[model samples]
Target: MSRTIKHEEKYQQFTIELDGDEAELAYACPSEDVVDFTHTYVPKSERGNGMAESLIEEGLKYAREHNLKVKATCPAVAKYINAHPEYKDLLAHP
Candidate 1:
């Protein structure tokens, strides 16, 4: 099943929804050239289940599809990119 990414403005957070519950939350700082993902975390119950990686992976797919560059400031996002070399092209200044 496909998950959805939802932005909750009141909470100032982005959530990756898996079947309705939040799998992960992502916070980003946007800029003219790139979007810096400042924080990304999954609930303790969801950890070790690849939920966070799923969100980051889909987020990267969205960025590349929209021609956006990524500046992953969030340690989770940064590590995701490093491990997934295929996403390197979407990195800012890459």
Candidate 2:
């Protein structure tokens, strides 16, 4: 048997940096206990580095710390939750 193939991560690694120039990722909240996860958009130049995930994670972390809930309307946010069910409870009310 002979098989050779390269393996790589399908997505970028999530990370957040509070630099003066780093994009804020457009985190938004329309109301209390509600976070609009989809509004955030990382620049194309910054794509494929999990930067979006980092931003979402950071925002959610903030909400958790502040005892606030989240409404993952953003596709990225929902994808993250899909990858991490621990955050399923954060999904917005039906």
Candidate 3:
């Protein structure tokens, strides 16, 4: 399946549309230079298609482009970051 992801900056979300359903990676700005990835959701039928991974990747890309650090409050996001070391530098400094 083909998926197109969109970043809705106003909503602080990265979303993907699939068969009329929407999956999203939602975030909040805890500080001017920090993005907290709070949640990610994909409909049951849409799961296992790499939707969540795509959303996380897109969110990370946005963080990088804006020179923002990331706080992965969501387990899935943290897991993704752990698996992808290239994004580790984006993690917010403690």
The residue-by-residue lDDT of candidate 1 on 1-94, one tens digit each, is 4556776646645677654456654556466556667777776766887778877877777678778798887889999999989999889873
**How many clashing residue pairs, candidate 2?**
1
Q: Comparing candidate 1 with candidate 2, which one achieves the higher TM-score?
A: 1
Ranking by lDDT: 3, 1, 2
> Which digits, one per residue and each the tens of the lDDT, describe model 2 over residues 1-94?
1111111113211233333334333445568666565455655666676666666777667667767677776677777889988777766775
lDDT against the true structure, per candidate, is: 0.73, 0.58, 0.95
Q: After superposition, how far is residue 35 of candidate 3 from its true place, in Å?
A: 0.4
Pick the lDDT winner. 3
Which runs in model 3 stand beyond 4 Å of their true positions?
Answer: none
Question: What TM-score, computed on C-alpha atoms, does each candidate reach?
Answer: 0.74, 0.65, 0.95
Task: Please give the lDDT score for candidate 1.
Answer: 0.73
Strongest candidate by TM-score: 3
Q: Which TM-score value belongs to model 3?
A: 0.95
Per-candidate total of colliding backbone pairs: 0, 1, 0
